[model samples]
Target: MQSGHNAMTGFVTVILALVIVIVGLVSRWPLWVWPFAAGVLSTGAAASLVRARRRRPLIPPERLLEPELPIPQVERWECVIKDVSLPSLSEDYDFQFSATVRWLPQEAPPNAPVVNAGGLAIDAVVDRARRITHQSPPHRSSLVQHRLNGELATMVADPSGRVLAMADNVRLTLADADRERLEKLATVRKNEEVWEHERKWEQSKRAYLGEDVLRTPGSAVVWWLAKNDEKIDKTVSDIGLLAELSSAANDQSVPDDFQRYVPGLAKEQEPLEAMADESTTGPPSPDEYARFLLRHSGLPDGDPRRALYLERVAEAAKGAGLPDVADALLRMLGDFPHPPQSAGPAEPPFDGYFDEDPPYDD
Candidate 1:
């Protein structure tokens, strides 16, 4: 508007200047007046020309067809599926899953069939998680949940490509009862391992005793000396007892080499001459048999060793189911006399002798 007004004012000024020039000429004005008029006409013309050059030409009205509408955009939506039950590798056990899911519907051609976008998104996310959970044990739900979180954090195009789905804050859980059962099972497995190891140790110990340490009286003595190097005398004294224990453990009689150390043992091994005598008036009674065995023990009357021998024989008779003979021998042992005080402190009885009886009676 301003440029057009300036152009009109300049045109008016030029017209006025031209009229003055023409009137001055027709009226025969002074030459100075003509120069002034010429200057005015020049100024007006210059202004008009400058204004016309600065003015912008009108732009034709743009074609007014309605603005083309942007293709309607499909907005992404969010759906949360919580407490969904999923199967696990363990029988009768299921995983509980929950997640916040976001998805976008795929661009479809016109006349496309209607579909459930939210349902498809949920199914896609759940199915993707199930693929992992189904292969995992119920007790490993936390680990599987971690894996699912990483996988579902990124958007994935569904198999049908109808929608893109992603998930966050994923969770998986197992029943408390199942978790407890797994813990107990693990404990039992560990206990079973311990028991197996203990059993093996016990068997090894038995084999060592039977096959190595106690194989014979000599081996037994060697083993005892190795353990008690300073107890040599004690070891020698206990050799007979060790032999007896070893024989008992192996279910055998004492070795002949050791029989002399155990009084009454050699006599027991020999057949009774009185029993074989055809002229014998009758079989000896328990008392007579006990006295005969005592006499053959080779330990003299009033000797502490004799009492020890009697005690051992009684124990053996009792073990052999001869209760009457055992009783008779015990009575004889109780009646056995002790040596005079002048004998001094009697030598300590050997390990196998006088186990329950005093070396001397008071």
Candidate 2:
């Protein structure tokens, strides 16, 4: 059928060209004009014919195409109860148990080994939930908390696979103060982690964009180093881990030989003197103050103040729902000569959600 169509098209093109020549001759056109018009028409017709010849389909759409199958849609719950509470009698003799579960958009670490308590993986889920909630950043902490709560809210079974009372709408409420504290913690942890990560990343960049590269004037290496220096400086400023340097500057700690070699020592003296005169009101709570000291402490490990700082910081960390940090600070006291029992195991978990820190036990 295509061949027949092409033949018909060719015949029509020939008839049109003949008519054009006839009209040109009847009008007494120049001899050169007749040949030129015929040549342009013939060339255009040949090109069109060639293009038509080359336009064959490699595979016919109707022949090669297959019908698309409908995709199967699966209905998923907003939250799924991963584990139910083990059956146990309450003080009032009623069946009692809780569950550890996960919410939708589940991206938490896989649940750990289950401790069999009436066939319910209570311990495993609980531990996993703990790990998820342990994230330090405020926004991330809140998100993880929500996810944990979602998992917990969906619990509908007892340890023996028996259905328990389930709420139609599980809504966990938090007081404003409690919410604020969590947000503060999460933000602090996030910033601290980012500062640490960026610090390490800056160190790693030095291998490629070190001082030696910066010394190469007008080169690509020099440009690269300059660009990276801005980022490195910003990270350093944000982390603000310059307490040691600042302390040294303020204390006239530089040796004579170092002063002779290093410039700007004399110029910094006025500012240092001014800073020494300004007094701070100190942090609000012992915990907040302790954290400040922990971050800003510039004392040497063997200095007497080092142990004092750590001790105070540990107290503050514990009060701030930062048991891990507090424990770490306490471990730093191994070198100090205090009573054997002072360095005993950690205090028990804080009593209620909003409970005040109990008096520090020796």
Candidate 3:
């Protein structure tokens, strides 16, 4: 647009100049049509300039990328397993999931062991997203978590099923099967958590003194999602893998009464289920949970009381919904060391709000 406007302006200026010259030359060529001569010169110059500008393409013409051909509608023929041939990527068996399938979930690696959708075995290879079904498990919902564990030879169409390519990422997914597993595991996990929380003080104090960690499920997926704690010092991280867990959970829709019907799960972590939906920022633990605490504390870098604030001040941040406060307090230990004189217990764990970030209301 700018170029065209400049061209038009230049053309008009040339014409004006020609008119002036013609008027000046009229005195010399009294009988000649000076205006005609001026018009011709201006028209020629403007035409040539406009033509030249159009010949140059704006941005380089991009090569035409081939679009994928639509998949043929299979007539649904039952080809009995005369010889069932599945897709395999490497003869030496090196699984490569370098890139993830765009349609498949990118939250976790598309591996069988990770998802186990619909209760399929760990060795299942997902060729494509087939169908999702909600069958009840033997006692509850029929949930099987399935994931792929190897590089997949993807079927790219060339009119016929002749050309197959190994995509950088496998299309591993957890359909209804996987979701069922996650929900069930979550219930069992909740049960374990409640058991542990009932005795976390005993567990942590003992571990702090000498005994080994009480060894709960660690619920890696739970923390991976809602870890507002410091990732630097935390054992788990946002970058870590929960594709296995997430894929399984996402594959199926949670039962309408998932929380209610899920016997032990929703019961165990009532605070978490009630406080917030699972996110990439769950609670923190002892190991590296402290580091995550530092990041969320919003204190100045290297605050002297940060450790004490986390360890001593934030202990007040606890109640029915706080399963991960330990890491928060420990991370902010340097900020608030000693609690207020009349803030309840003097040597309490951490002293401020439980459901919210610290400093306190009263």
Candidate 4:
């Protein structure tokens, strides 16, 4: 409107300038009048040129006929939710969560229903975090918090798609007392597992010894041989003691075949005259006692029992600080016969002991 008014005024001024020039020529006006007319004409021409340059171009009818794009309407806001308590996997335990939530409402039509974007954002972020915390124990709140920070760091649209929300600086925690209790409980559970393992090991050991190794004198001999195959001589010498120990453990008497090897059995059957002779001699030497015991046992010189009885006397001599007597008895054992070979298949190398039922009834 201003540009048009300026153009009209300039046109009128130009016409007046033309009339003045014509009148000056026709009526013999003064030279000053011509300069005034010329000045007026130049001013009008400048005004018209300014208006024409400033004018906007006209739009084509087809351009106006095209459809116009709708402008998007987005509402963005932020809020801080503090001390939000959420349940955890454990009963009587909850996670305390706090974070800054930023929300961006999705673009909708002008007639779309309006909703509380801030509340939706808070609910979406809190609910998403709650799902993770609910599956995690109270003691693992820090770990769960780390996971939430990663998951909620990005904007995620709500289920209804009305708003997108994101969380930052997420903090999940448990009460001091609850955290301490959980730590102690974890320690206790770990110790319980160790204790259970040790208890099982002890039970297995007892079963192996009671039912397999020491079930009988013969079984004890075989088990000892499996363990100390290189010490065959020593095993043969300890056979008497092993048989005695096995019998005592089972609350049974030593087998008759092994009675001669056991000192307790041989001593009970010794004659009074022999005891008197030992009294008369004050006390027999270790070698003499070994020979006497072997004779009373009725075991032959090459019998393993002879070596076993001699070894027992040798151990007694050593305990009594008689090295010379012990050496003599050991030399006697060396002269004894080697153990008989088995006619059956050779036993496998001993890896470890295992439990099994005893061969005989209790």
Best by TM-score: 4
Candidates in order: C-alpha RMSD to true structure: 19.5, 32.8, 37.5, 20.6
TM-score of each: 0.50, 0.20, 0.20, 0.53
TM-score of decoy 2: 0.20
Tell me the tens digit of each residue's lDDT in model 3 across 1-362: 44776777687777777776767676676445566766777787677677766775555546434467477785321111111122222122112112232212213434523532222211122233211112213222112212321223342322222222222233222335545656797799999998889798776775643322212112433444344454543434322233233323345322323323334433433444433543654542443345444544666654554655565434544542454665455544534445444556655343335546656578
Computed on alpha carbons, the lDDT of every model, listed in order, comes to: 0.81, 0.50, 0.41, 0.81
Q: Point to the candidate with the largest lDDT.
A: 4
The residue-by-residue lDDT of candidate 2 on 1-362, one tens digit each, is: 45775797789788989899789878989878977887888887788777777787667767774658576897432323432322111121111123423222222235644433323433344444444443423334335445655655454444333223222232223345545766787799999999999999988786444334322222332354356676865533322122223334345344322332234543333333334554543214333333345535876444666777687767667787777767767765666655334576876654444446555669
Ten contiguous residues with the weakest lDDT in model 4: 349-358
Overlapping backbone residue pairs in candidate 3 total 73
Stretches of candidate 2 off by over 4 Å are 1-32, 35-43, 50-55, 58-127, 134-362
List the pairs of residues colliding in candidate 2.
Answer: 137-186, 138-186, 138-187, 287-316
